[model samples]
Target chain A: MREVAAAERRRRTARLLVHGALAIASAATLFPLVWMLAAAFTPNDLILARPFRLWPEQATLANFAAASEAYPIWRWLWNSLLAAAAVTAGKLALSLPAAYAFARGRHRWRDAAFGFVIVTMAFPTVMVIVPTYLAVVRLGLVDTLPALIVPSIPYIGFYVFFFRQAMKALPPEMFEAASLDGAGFLRQFVDIALPNVAHVVPALAAFAFLGAWNIFLWGQLTLASVENKTLAVGVALFSDIEGAQSSWGPLMAVNSLAILPVLVVFLVARRSIERAFANR
Target chain B: MRGAHGGSLQTAGLVAPAFFAVAVFLYLPIAASGLLAVLDYHPATRAFSYAGLANIEAVWRDPAFRVAAWNTLVYCLVLVPAQVVVPLLLALGLREIAGSRLAPVYYACLFAPTLVSFSVAGAVWLPLLNPINGVLNEMLIAIGLPPSRWHTDARAALWVVCVVTFWKTFGLNLVLWYAALMTIPREQIEAARIDGAGFFRRVRDIDIPLASPTAFFILVTTVFTTLDDIVGIIDVLTGGGPFERTTNLPYLLWQKGLVFFQFGQASVVALVTIAIVALLTFVQFRFVERRVTYA
Candidate 1:
């Protein structure tokens, strides 16, 4: 009985130690972001002053006003929303049907086609980006929203693979029952396959939205005009123009704006995202 | 049989749009990169002339290419293992607190930075890393330690870049690791403990093997993202500067092709980068795939 109590005490100690360490690590990991948040609301002079303030002396809206005045912050935010939404929709539209085909439809060359799509997952966008940019230039699509959205959609290899796996796990009998009800292929896909895999949509949507919204290099190259830039690209531009000066306040403010929508999206979808990744 | 035939046709129709777009944007560009590497295009004449092995030879001899190649290797070597091991450790710790209220807080905090774009991450770090009015330096001064340039120092630039990149992106791997860890049945570990297997032995003999599939997935994705995502951070933070200390092959490709308009040389760099990724992937599948337990 004494030995068991000793072991229990040891286990509790270990648990406390582990939890304590994790808490410290979490604080350190979040410090940069927390600092950015604090700086965004702090006055610029206090930010650049020595013995740096961890929290703002007085929170102010001046930084946001200043950031918007300096750049088309609102316009960039709109562009980011448009580009991310369009790209996410395009990916879902194309990949859902294709994944349905791969998972349910009978075809001789289905695996071959799936292989063809999945192989591109290995091809980094940077590898093909040069030629893609040149193609955009040739088509007179540079600096346009399509240039950002259209090419972004085709990198759906991971999405298709994921959705196909999700769809394949559905019982074959479910689809057979739908077919017995005289449902056509398109009808079965739209009504049965898609609805069954709807749990995955939020997860894939979060991934696609984050991927598209966080587009920096492509947006930088494609969207040349300041007015056309996404929030991701605009933040970079704000930093560059502001340079290594005392404008950390406005820069952090812009940075906050860039991350706000995505953070909200991620937090809202966190549970489904957790489930989706856990299963896959 | 006739209905099955019609289903196949419909399948083809369903797959065609995605296939076509991927071909044009992804596969076609990949193929065109190869073609453009060998053929010289003149803007003046709007004509292409075969350049033979000139582009390949040029990139091979270029000093910038050599540095970029080395830096790329350094990145992969450092990032791939760190991303794999660190996250697995965190995931194990997280599993211990699975049912507790603190679990969500840990997940939310760790995963927060990963959701932020690379550009914003870079922007956030810029002020903190600034040598002169930066918070980092101010802290150092307060502690009676000499302040140092973070990304500004040539020797430290690559490491700084790596640290920031790791900070920004490691959460994805952490999530993947956590997910993989959850799949391990409790009975197996309890059984092992009953069988007198120590902690290290249990982890080595069971947990590691069970998690190998996610480990392999994490390894491949980490390398790819390290190549693609670092460019934005590099652009915003150092611009691959402090004397080109942080320029990897992808950044080199961007610089050569887009910045310098040397499309031929950039194509060569691009092909080399692709070859490196392909080779690493092949190696992983050949060697690591065998050990990955499907469940």
Candidate 2:
């Protein structure tokens, strides 16, 4: 009876300790974002006030209103959305069949080609920036969306490889059955393979969207006009180029706005996001 | 059987478009960069000369290039360990925490910064570090410390950049380390505990050794990722300013090629940077493969 009581106490203590540790970690992780949100809502004058108040005396939308007026927030958002959509669509359309072939088709050079794709990832992106710029200039694609979209296609080799790896995990019997049913290769992909790999589509799309949206170097170097600038490059323009004073309130407001779409995507696709990392 | 043969050919045909598209758009540009590095090609004059080793030699001799190289080395040296260690420590602390219910909430909080772009991170950090009217300054003043000029001061700028980069990326590393930690067999840990091992001993002797492979993987990838792609942070934060103290090789490539229109020289810098990264990655991979034991 005494031993049983001791065991129960030990179990209870373990549970309590675990709960306490989790609470502290969760708070630490969320602190910066909570602070950002609070600062966003706090009146401008109260933001830098001493002692760092957790809650503002009064909440206001003046920062957001000023942010919109200070920059082309709507235009930047539209540009980002369009570019991200195009890149995601382009990557999927291009990667799907290639992945299918690599996964399902039998060929002598299959492994070699796949290996080539992986090896290319080792090439530092910075090394190719200058040459790519030259190519874009030669193709008259500077300042155009195609310049952004086209360069991204080759970089999707990793994505294609990931998809192929995922597809390889599916049973091969399905392909054989499809072939027996008079379905050709294209038909089989449409019917059997697509359905099997559907779960990975959203995850891949999220990866591509985040990648294309946050592309700052390519956009900054390639796009010359403010009209063509994406949200990242636009927000960067707020920095004082020549020791001019910068507006902290409007800058933070714009920064917060710029991250909203990605934040929304992450929240909505939380499962897929977790799965992508989990699988990796 | 006849359909199978035909199906294979059709599949290959279906895949050709993508392969070709990537070759033209991705591989072709990379190849062109290599070719351009050796030739003296001025965009303005449309002139081309076989400069051979001249551009490479210039990059080697330039003091500014050397500074950029040193800055990159220092940044990577400091960041790789911090990124790995902080996340690993957090994951360790997380394991002791119960209530699997809070796991998702914690993950969401930790992983939040990964979704946000580097540009946004730089912007947010800028105001917080501002000398005047900045929260950091206000906090320092309250604590009886002097204000810091953060991005403006040459000495402080690199550290500020490092902190911002860490904030933007540490979450991703946390997830990776956490997943790796999960893969450690519960039985082994329980056995170690039953043998009278303490918490730190179990972690240091058992858990870390088991997680070494994952840690190594993160290290190599982080080096490449940060070295290759951190130009965005430089552009947004310091613009490699206050005397170009923060100009790493990538930004230097941009400065030469775009800012100065010295395409030939920039290509040289890019080539050298790629060569260095590839060499280091290869060496690190080979070294880690011998030491890392996979469960």
True contacts kept of 2: 0.54
Q: How would you encode candidate 2's per-residue C-alpha lDDT over A54-80 as one tens digit per residue?
A: 564488878778777766777888889
Q: Which ranges of candidate 2 are over 4 A from the true structure? A: A1-32, A42-57, A241-245, B1-8, B98-100, B204-216, B292-295
Each candidate's interface RMSD: 1.8, 2.8
Q: Pick the candidate with the highest DockQ.
A: 1
User: Clashing residue pairs in candidate 1, if any?
Assistant: none
Docking class of 1: medium
Instruction: Give per-residue lDDT, candidate 2, residue B127.
Output: 65
Looking at model 2, the pairs that clash are A18-B98
What is the per-residue lDDT of model 2 for residues B108-127, given as tens digits with 9 covering 90 to 100?
Answer: 77777787787777776766
Quantify all predictions' global Cα lDDT against the true fold: 0.87, 0.76
In model 1, the runs with Cα more than 4 Å from the true position are B1-6, B43-47
